[model samples]
Target chain A: MIWPFITRSLGIATILLLAAIGELLDERAGVLNVGIEGLMLFGGAAGFLAALKWGLLAGFIVGTIVGGAFGLLHAVLSITLKVNQVVSGMGIWLFAMGFVTYWADRYSGPLPMGMVSPSIHGLSPMFFIALAILFAIWFILSRTHLGLKIRSVGEDPSTAEVSGVNVVKIRYLCTTIGGLLGGLAGAFLTLTYLACWSHLPTMGLGWVALALVQFSIWRPPILLAGALLFGFIWQFAISPETIYAGIPAPLPVLRMLPFAVTIIFLTVISSERFRKKWALAKPAALGQPYIKE
Target chain B: MIGLRFPKLKCERIVILTGADAVKISALSVVISFMLFGAFVAFEGTDPLVAYEHIFSFAFDPKLGLPITLHRGFFLVFNTLAFIIPMAAGIWNIGMEGQFYLGTIGAFAVAYSFPDLNQAILIPLMLISGAIFGAAYGALAGFLKGKMNVNEVVVTIMLNNIAFWLVYLLTVGGPWAGIAESTSKPLPKNACAPMVWNTPFTSIFVIVVAILVYFFLKKTTIGYQIRTLGSNPIVAKHVGISAPKISVIVMAIGGAIAGLSGYHMWAGDPAFLMIPRPEAYKAIGDLTYWGIILGLICLLNPLTSVPASIFIGSIIVGTTVLVRRLRMPFGLDVLFLGIISLVFAAFQFFHQYRIRRVKVVIGK
Candidate 1:
């Protein structure tokens, strides 16, 4: 049970970190991708099906492409048309719910379950993929010129534009990249976590990842730590063996630890007086929609 | 137009002022939502005719369908009040699920302790006790938010999980253990509210409660304050209103209403008093969220919730009839409703903002 706990925690953390990191990028580029869950579902189905046809690499590539397309739709509606971000995100969710269920039912034979795309080391191949992607994202978001430009767009799009940063293009690219990461997260869920195609399979993970951003305060490094903590709470709370093993508390109550932590984090940070004093690091234009002047 | 136009004014910020056109917008929204919902149903690969028939059979037929549907409807209505009131106060009381459970547990505890209590005393006491239990649970979240600035959404969601476990722990350990499942003992007969309509779902308690709640919202100072706070807390504070205090009160009231809703469920359908099967799920009167959705469809107007619940109730009834008659799937009804909600939410945006792409003829 403990081993299973450790493994599950590791898997959950990986997926959560991927999604959170994607969201962080989008937020940093002044676009809030609230429809991460939808993109993930679409990605999961596309990637899973692609893996069955071609291979894992093909699956990953297909997932990224599909995800990029959805991101483009988001960017066009939000960045270009200037629709309300929240509503557009919700529209994306509705559209995905319709598309994925229909697609999953129509295409494919038996859905994949139990194992991820072929293993690299003792760990599932996804573990290595996640590690490589995380490092790549960290480097791209922090050290590179493009990363600086993206960050400045979120911080002050007007200033970034004045600096000849082509804010719209950078925002469009970052949002698409965010979608690609979101797709990878979903693909990992199907190919690694649950290892199956499911209806609303992502459950509430997308929303949870959004909350995780607040928990980590948008820092990529802290996102990893936050994901691990959340995963630990989730794993501990649902382990039936731990519940029956003379543990002083019921398991369901413990399952609540992640939510409690989120509430505490939000509460501590959102307090007016506290916020006014030493402000927590937050994406300047987190949920705001971009309207080019 | 009643020969009326905008009054001459220096400065006005009236965007979407109320008129008969508002009704047209809402009516259009409902139509659009239903169309979208129908498209989703078709995509699910079931003949919706069959599905709609099943729901109707369940809602109106004198058999298992009507009784259960009515029972569910009453509880849903009861829960909606609990949810909407707090929402009006600008607090998304997602903890209604927990509060409902607490209310049910509290009602059961009281009834079980004094089985011989007179019906006159027992019924009112059960309702009050349930309300108190719910209020207490809701107050915890409110207090946390007011004192700690904790986001209500996160706290309420967590509280719901806590409520689920709390019920599990208590029923497993305490005297509410059912004869079959280890849930609460059967609710005493004397504690049950008297029936108004000869139907299973229509209870005198539900109707009386609805009226009281309506009056409480429209004709009361607390209700006014809650509405004011919900609209703008900063303005409310400037006008010497304590936003936190109103929040606490509104949440408590919301919880109490929700608790009463749970109590109604117990009285209406004592069968649910038992714990769930090998899977440890408990309803504890969860018809609230759907009721709230229906309530929102009616523009969150309390008066509208009544007819909306019945109309939505009819749809549920209609769908059940379709299910058995047409051999459609069972859970597809909910999916249809969800699609409807999504459509309704989307259409609401369009209704609020009308887009007109026009060319600017500067030279002309």
Candidate 2:
């Protein structure tokens, strides 16, 4: 029971890790994207369809590419055109939710769960991919000169520009990479973890990832720690049938565990009093569209 | 290497829109959304123009769908205002979905308990209870946002899921089942919304509320304070305006209106007269999102929200007509909305900048 729980929880956490790291990169580069929710849906739908036509591997690549494409659209709107990031993200979400639902109904029937190989410790290679990506991101963000430039851009784009950093290109590059990872996460969600696609296969996990970015305070290693805890809680709450066998709690109520936890944890972590210390280092220019003069 | 000349695209932030230009931009947004949406429909192996014909026949004036569109508009207006009112204080009230649901439960509580109460008394009582429930929920989010600085977007979103689960618990054989397990017990038919002009009387009620909200933002002292707070918090702070208090008050007000819409949507309507099944949010349930979209579309103007609601309502009603006819693809409502929002955002760019064609020299 413990082993199975650990494996399942890690599997769930991987999804969060992928999406959150992508978002963290954007935030670190002084951009806020609230549309990761829709991006994930687009990735899931596209990945599932591609997998149906091609194979599992094609699904992953297509999903990532689709996500990157949407990310580019978002980048053009937010970074280039300087549209309101939140509204643009919300628009993307509404479109994705609608399009995915309609597409799923039109093109897909009940799908058989696809199988993946090379499961180490009962976790697929997706988990390793996530760990490796997480490690790489951690290294690039902390130890590299590019990391300093990104931080400088997030803190003060004008200053960074004066320092010779091309703020727009860096922001766009980060956003595209973020979208790529987000897409891969969605592909993994449909083609590997859940093994099938539905209307919203991620089920607001993208939002949970958004919350996780805040919870981790934008640090990569800390994010990993938080994802593990979140993963365990999510797994526990998602399986009320097993957990609440003796207590007889309502299933839907139990199903809301992860969301409820997200809200509770978010409030506690982000409350002004608690954040006075941690919010100090938060990206200063985050959510502000920089206009080149 | 030889140099070749080509054209490159550029934008200047100098071209500001005139009054007429604003209207043109707005029209451009609608046209682009329609074209993009139509392109999707055409790609789906159908005649997009023919599908639109069925929609217009159903959704426009002098048709059977006008009343339904207006009825839907009433709810969309309230939802829009729900966003607009709190917006005056710079608070984003995305919790209308949860607040609306709680209002239904609140309305259901009153109607179920006093089924034999007088029509006038019962309806008013239901409305009050609904408003109270909605306001309390909204205020909770507001309080967290104001005092605790919790992110309202995530909090409201989570609250929506919680509210829906609560609905599922109550209606699905959990002490509130009426004719079926998935519905609350019916309210007395006499408790229906007072109707006039072939639409819910709430149509008039919504207009009055919108006008009142417009005045509330423009004329009142608190409105001034709200405006100042929204425009600049540092000035508000110096003026001794309490940010948290205003946040809670505006959110509560917004929530109250959305909650009132809950009664109008189902409980107080002759068509429903009780909360019905969860059809992916239990009808008019997830429609709270339409308000969010409309709030953005109207640029958070309380008065503009009314006509905008009607426009959106017609589109939804029209698309719904096409969905029934099976001549058009489903999800057109959301597709249209997403396109509208995206186009509006894009146009916001155009509102400030004009495209400039620059000549570029290339090495070949």
lDDT of 2 by residue, B161-197 (tens): 7888888788877778787757777777757878787
lDDT tens per residue, model 1, A170-236: 8888888888888888877776676666555775567678777765666778788888887777767
Candidates in order, TM-scores: namely: 0.80, 0.93
DockQ of each candidate's interface versus the true one? 0.26, 0.60
Q: Please give the lDDT score at residue B292 for candidate 2.
A: 77
Which candidate number has the best DockQ? 2
User: Chain A TM-score for model 2, please?
Assistant: 0.94
Candidate that scores best on lDDT = 2
The backbone clash count of each candidate, in order, is 23, 2
Q: Which window of 10 residues has the lowest lDDT sum in candidate 2 chain A?
A: A109-118
Q: Give me the overall lDDT of model 2.
A: 0.82
Regions of model 2 farther than 4 Å from truth: A113-122, B1-10, B14-23, B61-63, B179-181, B268-271, B280-283, B355-364
Q: Which ten residues in a row have the lowest lDDT in candidate 2 chain B?
A: B278-287
